[model samples]
Target: KKLDAKVKLWHHNSQGLFDYSTKDFQEYTLKWRGDAFLTKSNNRIQNQPSLPKTPIAKLKANDLALYPGHLFASLCQDLWLVARSFTNGYRLAPGDIVRLGAQAFKVKQICTDKPTNKGFSLTDLLVFQEPSGETSQVHSLPCRVCLSESYSSQNPLISPCNCKGSMKYIHLKCLQQSIKSRVHSTDYSLAFMFKNLSCELCSKQYSSKFYLNGELKDLLEIKNLPQPYVVLESLSCKEQGLYIASFCTKSILSLGRSHQSEVLIKDPSVSRNHAKLVYKGQGIYLKDNKSKYGTTILVKRPISLKENPHLEFQSENSTIQFKASGLVNLLPSCLRQPVAKGPKSPSLPLFPVNKGICLSTDDLDFLVREAQGELLNTSLSFCQDSIQNFEA
Candidate 1:
């Protein structure tokens, strides 16, 4: 083909080494070999000739627009430009967080005025910067109780209650300390001690964060139906021995001096039918039979713990065999180890030397106090001297 006019082939340096200050065209011969571009130049185009030999397309710097932190759709306002960029390999989708300079913005939504080729639309993207600064994000939220950053050193904040926003974030340690303070307070309610901790806002019990560990979870979950059992200690009966009685389901146990009673109390002080230990479901109830000396549930408080934190046993008649139902919630981590239920023989001992349900110091304290009064502040720390003094 013969040339019609003077042709000026301009190929920009792909490596960006040689700087071109002006559009002043230099003399160069352009040739085509089966759609491959052949540009003959020296000291101008340093790399390979990537430009197409065909004159049907041309590359112009003005054809490209670079906009940061701004929507490309709004800047161009033309569906063709947006579609052109999409064909040129630029991904713009909803919920994708794009970065511009030091700020981050998330794409909220995408809408288009009209459909384009192949069911694709030139989208009008909507993006909003995510919450930043020293208060809005999680890094800025501080523990209200400790007055320090909650996640500075990997200390997680728990929002178990109804508190919202910044007030909701609180360190687990701080929350535990606050609960301990309330437990030790003079006006602390004993009823609330067994129940869940109430939130300061709604005054309703917290759904989560009820227990730091699985103590509460284990107490609430009753695995197998427990066989009712009772241990009697410190009774002024004739023998003054630790007695264990495993009764049948829904059966009534009679505690009296008469031999007809299931549990024989050979003492003159005890009436013919002193008290009845009624077993129903998973609970054991004590009903006084209107005797002269009323029935009282005796519980021995755990004052001093042994060298091992898990092993605790105090000698003498101070120990009380609390019924399984009332004492399950007062377990001091001993019940954490699953215990297998033995046979349903009434002759079986409740807590024998070899196979016995060992009670912790905290379990004993709570059991004793709960039996003595209706309302008593409960503490899991039975080893502490502040709780009570033992006979030594």
Candidate 2:
């Protein structure tokens, strides 16, 4: 076979890794946030079943909305940030913190660009770096996806990207760090507007951050025709930049950071025995991990999670229900302890949990006040003491 000088075989996906041949090059798809993409002129719409519009009251900072892929896309953005690196090889999981440059930025989107014969590309990545480097051509999709997968260990000298092999490449996160402090340094648009729109299905509300984007605009907004059973959206922006990660009828992104966990829904009837949830960044996977079927998870509205840190997770049918907000943002980390490879970090006192522990909420509150500015987990010790004392 002849090769074009302009053609270069660059990236490969390791998903079906055991075969080694799984590295075949193909175009990855990255959709925009508000605009899901549609390639077929005959069919370009997204359809989701209705969800309850009622927002849950009194949700804790960590309480989450349970839904399929909802967690990985939103709450677990950080986790996806960590895991995204595995798109190459290294697998990541919850509770792992990636250390890199001294700054942080939001993951604006993940996308796969239009394909080329030489090889396919994933493009248009977003992040806010400190000092303030932000976006770069090298920082686009596939590159950023890989960089966000691993944690930053103090062991320097080795570059943060950690990628190796013949198809050697760059780290999008590193590229982001390199572009510090430029005016409007971010490649993502500074503006966002999600205040007024209802999910095409239940008309459920979602936050602005979790805005939907897909190519099937007509079918989604047709107002009368039977919408397609499945609608897909990618991470796109107002200017029409789409990232490669895919979202569908059962999937939606969650909105901010908090104590909630991302929710997942799976119907065996829809697919075969295989069902899994992946956070592209932090690399946490919650599927049939180590639990039996029918496990239940409860989450409140407006749940938030740090960009995906690995955490324990399980899901079932309607048993995994969440409010409208669940789909918009990844919820926060749990109030209770989480499993991690690192040393045990402290936990904060969950005022709501005090009652069961025999500690008064007010009393726990007072202790927390005293511990202000201390390590996050240190304050939790005070509450534990109060409980141990009361129980005695």
Candidate 3:
């Protein structure tokens, strides 16, 4: 009869229970049985699956009624309380201020552990206590680099990286000088400055820029020589840091894994002379040199089918091809509006009805004319800011 009742229960909840695997289903059944036993006896049974250490732990047998309405109604109060607790709870996040009596702390980092199948997770917080009334006036610690206690508002001491102990604190100027000594070159005209700007001990990369006395400052100062410069940040785990290559009008900057190349990538996939960046007519263009893993760019906007019927682009490991049929126009009439006469607004490539077209990585030369400025503007801005600081 008990087996028959269990079978009936399984059949009744089959729609909702079917998603669970055999193991999960068995565990859930065990949990339900354990919960029922605990509710009746108020004691844990051997080898019985435990209930969640939540308010629902004391769930009565009536709460698991066969009918949905009865079950929901019986469990409503506990569930509502749980929901309310979660909604009203405050979670500690990075940059949050936590108070402990008279002392205050600033949360620096929050590390969370992956949740278990039993719905158990652990979180750890790294925080530093803020200086209080009398402690704020003290400045006895010396800079790690210069070993001087002379700290001013302009050249204040800071602990930016994850390095602890005596190596933790250093004057901003001393730190900058130390970094400058390790720089590949001082000239910013047409050179690459590639150095791992990370703490050697902690293996933590220093912030590219930081704030000092409410003024923003660049960690690595680079003099601005001219415009039309390209900064390539290495994504390889072995090689890191910015590779700045400035270009003159009609000048070419070569990139490859070989040291002979102007911008060395140091990756196996890159050919000896993988690609070239040509600067001409107020813009920079990339030309691939028949590389093993051909050069590719991110497609920010849709390509026009009217201009190129056959389109090819790389997505991860696969090369995708899109060939448009001349039979019908997929675009609406509103999108097919004529270009305006005034100053050219940044618009998507017009996809007018035309014969079938084909596009390859070689045919994306139009991107250099249109999207290069927008793409490089952010890096250029950072470089420009560093230049200003260098000049000052």
Candidate 4:
């Protein structure tokens, strides 16, 4: 009967089980006639029927409550469970529940390899504690930039960089205003006075994006920018953040490591004039400038051979060239009488010729082998003809 009750309860509240909160659990468990303060124990009760253990037995009740609905659901599914088993008797595993008075608590192991609140910073530790749903004195703290404690949903205080104490929290608008003041914007480009998007004191790059109260928010906001602008992001570890450069249809923007280049890349591998972006008509095209380390485009879909007749790509140490020519008509043009010349001939039976295909060193070697075989056949034929004539 207990087993049946448990099965029925699980079936009814399967959806809610994923995003189960303390309030929800308390409310739902009120209807249950079975043991209210139950633990996910592997050892069966002496007389009671068997009950299936909760899949999310590893998560502490407090930590589970702090999780967002999606994260809670993922935890219930055990998506991040490692395959290794905990052999140490001292170490508590998933499904091990402890009873304290009327309430039961589950044990969860959290990695403490990263130190908290050291000489470096306390922002991360404070941020972690902020989601506890408790009213804390931290809310009274003023913004470092504006020196105002007032904050609303429209313009909230955020700890974006690695700064501790009074220098930690700052209003989003104040930070944006500070960034805007340093930014040098012209008709063609927008350049930052600072090398990267980082805090002056901490020397840490500000997070590009962060979530607050389950809502996604951007750290930096650039407003009222010119149209037909291109934003380039550096993949290099040394340089970071988005660099914006605008261009007219007639003008070309040069990209390289040099200071003179319009879009500057501060990497050693990049040449002085690595590449150029040309805006023609409605389309933009990227062309290589014969750099030592050549430019590359990641091809996601099949490209039309007719539109792109010649294509060159670099693979490791070697450069590969692909060329496509007009289809070769195997039947002679004279053999087929010309029907009215419009643009294309339908009667020509066009076939792709090997000459138009991508040729490599292997293809040249195959041609050489064919020539040697033909010479050997010619020599054998000449010898047979001489023998026949001598016999005659």
Candidate 5:
């Protein structure tokens, strides 16, 4: 609280004590490795034909000799043209002209190796002249899609899609038409909503919405109809039958009393077209379709008289219910009686009895007559024996 003072800080050196000072060191000598005269001659030869010989600062000859090709390349301009040609796998021959920067250069000589002993050998090339406007590339490249070199209205080629080289460029109109056709033709499933306009080959989707005109945009709204299996059952029939259908497989099933319906109910209450089992994406929907008696589905079981306890019955119900033991006891005595064993009928001959031989109709008739005669004789003998025994 005693005498508080506010002070400002100084930003720069007030005395200017920080100052510049010059210093020097000895000029160290480097041992020369190659002939200086040859190096000078090579440098002079590399310069432009029209320019006078100009001496540059002396560089370490030994260092330059180690990489003679690199040193020679540093002296020239437009080296990229030759580098590009080499990258493209084009073999350069003498007299081959290369165009670069609005100028044309002819390959004058191809030196396979460097003749000097002081430097490393490189594929030396001597090219002639700079770029000249007199000669130019005249031929135009064609579009891969249309295969057209030029348009009447001079429509320029563009590559909006992910394609490379010759297959890249295409006219705007051609692209639009192609997209329109693809949208109309391709079938969309449940995944259609997430799908975008894409190249069939590359699967690269179209990102630019501006490319989609009104017609194409509207076409995008058309989605593939969902196809699902359905069960069509007739409620009226005592023996209920279910039909499986789908939009993809079977289109529709008409239900009614009429024979024309795919699922005939044979119920008087049902109309000719009582209901239609329509298959939509959501699920199998039951459309009434305006029938005489409206279609209804029982959601729950109804109450019976037994459950109500109000109505009394003494064997009045059509359906009979009994316990397992009581049901067996209630069965008729005739039905419960044991089966009797009777005299066996004469057995017929086995099929194809004699290996490969099969009995004909005449043979079968003869065999039947013989068996009947023998049975009749035996019955007559038995009756006579019974009569004699009874008389005795």
Candidate 6:
């Protein structure tokens, strides 16, 4: 009788726990490293003024946080609002306790071998376990996810398809919804962490902006700003407006792509015209309010694959059609083209010839010619956004 057959372990730190607790923490207030940053963020907090200075204990459990939904827990002080620069901020020591919604982890070890002027970054590998006495994260089968290495024959994948080169496999369901199969064999996953994500529609970046709720905690990455994560949901319309997430650097936090869905981090600063949009908790949001000439559709919450948005996203077999109505005449015959973020040509080598080797100019020129071919050896493909005239 294994008392904990269905144990769920989340390998996260204090920030994850704080984010998962947004609902109750909404009223809590936050302050940025600089007062101007505060003014900017407060303006973006959407539908709210300053964050209420409240206590965590008074909040309900449901408001704490959930991995799979937009409804999360937040807190006062807005620590994460400014916790940027993973190379600095927040020093963790052994036996330190950290919380992640419904679960708390302790620092077992800090690999402090690397030396930096910032006194060894806080980005240390943290180990945690279930206080229930069930299992530790290191030894658990479900919790362990490792990167692909040279002879990983024993690595089990969610599907027959193997992982992309140099990528480690993490449980899809750990932070975001898991894909039953990796259809195209992608190099990145929703489970992995990212630093920058641009809107596929407008090529605009999703930078740190207003948080849906007030909460903050020092994070490992980025000093003096929130340890933010970008969220993209398979949402249905209803929750309107651009679903904006606030964090410094506006880099992508995570990306999730399954059979019929894909989620990404956004900066929410793109133009609102003639573009396809996706947001957190929202599945696929399309807007025709731009009168077909230049339409702007915003995705607010999760929607179904059968819905209008996923039809374009989940064309497992083919491309989906875009149906424009009242504004069709205002749009172009073929305005809804996807972005062209095709396979980029390989970059040239940094040191064409070893700098210290004392090579002649002739040798350098030869190396340059060879590198040119590498740069030209790529093709055009869909990146994400494709802006143009449209059809009604």
- For each candidate in turn, the TM-score is 0.21, 0.15, 0.39, 0.35, 0.19, 0.15
lDDT per residue for candidate 6 within 108-187, as digits (tens), equals 32222222223222222222111222111122233224432222212222211123332213332321222122112222
Off by over 4 Å in 2: 1-32, 35-289, 294-297, 301-306, 309-392
State which candidate, 2 or 5, has the greater TM-score.
5
Q: Give the TM-score of candidate 4.
A: 0.35
Residue-wise C-alpha lDDT for candidate 1, range 1-392, written one tens digit per residue: 11111233234432211112235434433322111211223422111224322111111111111111112111211000111111111222222222111112232322221222222111111111222222212566777777687463324565655687667777765665665443211110010122224566655454331333223221111112123344333222222222333453335666667766766555555678766655543334445565543332111111111111122111111111101111223445564322212111111111111101121112434433432321232223432232243312
Cα lDDT of model 1 overall?
A: 0.30
Tens digit of per-residue lDDT, candidate 2, span 292-374: 22111122111122222222221111011112222343435563222212112123333222111211112434444433422
Model 3: per-residue Cα lDDT over 1-392, one tens digit each: 01001111112232111111122221111222211211112221111223222211121222221111112223311100000111212222223222111112232322222222221110111112222122111167777888888888777777766677777788878877876664353232223333445666676666665665555555656444344354443333454444455553326767676777776555555678866656544334455565554544322222332343333322222222222222333557576323212122122232111111111111224433323333353344433432344335
Of 2 and 6, the candidate ranking higher by lDDT: 2
Give residue 91's lDDT in candidate 3 (0 to 100).
Answer: 29
**Cα lDDT computed for each candidate against the true fold:** 0.30, 0.22, 0.36, 0.36, 0.30, 0.21
Q: Which predicted model would earn the best TM-score?
A: 3
- TM-score comparison, 1 vs 3, better candidate: 3
Candidate 4: count of backbone clashes, pairs at least 3 residues apart or interchain: 0
Candidate 5 accuracy as lDDT = 0.30
Which scores better on lDDT, 3 or 5?
A: 3
- Candidates 5 and 6 compared by lDDT, better number: 5
Off by over 4 Å in 6: 1-129, 132-225, 231-247, 250-313, 324-392
Q: Where does the lowest 10-residue lDDT sum fall in candidate 4?
A: 80-89
- C-alpha RMSD for every candidate: 41.4, 26.4, 24.6, 31.2, 52.7, 27.4
Candidate 4 per-residue C-alpha lDDT over 8-81 given as tens digits, one digit per residue, 9 for 90 to 100: 11122321121111222111111121212122223211111122232211111111111111221222211111
Task: Give me the runs in candidate 1 sitting further than 4 Å from their true place.
Answer: 1-226, 234-238, 298-392
Error of 3 at 129 (Å): 18
